[model samples]
Target: MNINDLFLCPICRNIPLSERESFLNGLNYHLKTYKKGAFIARQEDPVEALYLLLSGSVKTEMISDAGTVLNIEIIKAPKPLAPAFLFAENNRFPVDVIALEACEVVFLPKKSVMLQLSSNEAFLRGYMAFNSNRTNFLSERIKLLSIKTIKGKLAQYILSRARGNYFTFEINQTQLAEYFGIARPSLARSLSEMLEDKIITFKKNEGEILNMNALKELVVS
Candidate 1:
């Protein structure tokens, strides 16, 4: 699909690129497809350019020194993938990006990125706004990780997503464990403990808050 014909991306959505012919001409962008489990970018690799998810999805994987692999987040299409580091001093990827399925990505070169920044005021503004939102997201993720107990982590996760006392987690137990960066047995044990303590009442995908005040206290303390 044509880059200018498309909505561009979240950064360029408000400021359409189709109208800016001169700005559009300065950069080169093309599509690339990757098979499932293929590494789009390895950990510690230099940030080459902006990547917009054209179709399908990808995940960010973080590995500890002890080889503990934690899958951080899944990014869906039409969104920029980790462009915050593109302008950093080191400008290296902190995680390994892997395609979850057969995915298509909009790959922009570094030269194009530089040219867009120099020539397009709207692109620059949009890029800055994107980075600012990314900062907030990272800050919240750090806060979630900082909670020491399993119950605390679970509580935070539910609280973050729940509209009321009721919330439905789409991921199964195994996926939940991986998302929480803990073992399956440990996650199950914690949930069981929470149930016994009357902190939450869960059945399969759906769960209701039994003691929201306690959960809130758990998150902060």
Candidate 2:
């Protein structure tokens, strides 16, 4: 990806070409590519340059003491990784970022960030608005991860996407298992339990909610 691709990101949206060029010139930004399974940023790494994903996918993960890894988010291309952390007191990455596939990223130095923040009112406003949404997204993700049981996690996921009494899964079971931080067999077993309880019926990719109230109860209780 090239510098032109920066326009696709919300933070770079509507930024004037002259200001953009100056920002790039100040930092001497370069696009770097990483292969699959490469670590973009490790947990606790000091945050200096802001990384923007230009293409492919990256996963943010948190590893537990027991060696369990929970994938917190799968961020697709054409977006900034963590703009809010730029001004943080600790200024460190909280999660490990790895390339799920071949990917490209660009970074801008902290000096350039401060330069634009002080001079460009429009850019400053857009940057802040972008991080505000990020804060809310992180809050919701925290709630999702707080659910302890597999059934509860599955219930919350299903209810979030359910259209009335119907739900359809676009992702396959493997991806679902990875997202829920569970083994495929465990996910399959809990799903079978839901089927046995007659709370939901699913075949292939689509499912219909037979007992929405019961599914809701499963989430809270």
Best by lDDT: 2
> Which ten contiguous residues of candidate 1 have the minimum total lDDT?
1-10
Error of 2 at 118 (Å): 4.9
lDDT of 2 by residue, 88-127 (tens): 9999888899999999999888888788778877678879
What are the RMSD figures for all models against the true structure?
Answer: 3.5, 3.6
On residues 71-151, what C-alpha lDDT tens digit does candidate 1 reach at each position? 788887778888887878999988999999988888788889888877777888988898998888678767777888888
Candidate-wise lDDT, in order? 0.82, 0.85
Instruction: Give all TM-scores, in the order shown.
Output: 0.74, 0.74
Candidate 2 clashes between residue pairs 3 or more apart in a chain or in different chains: none
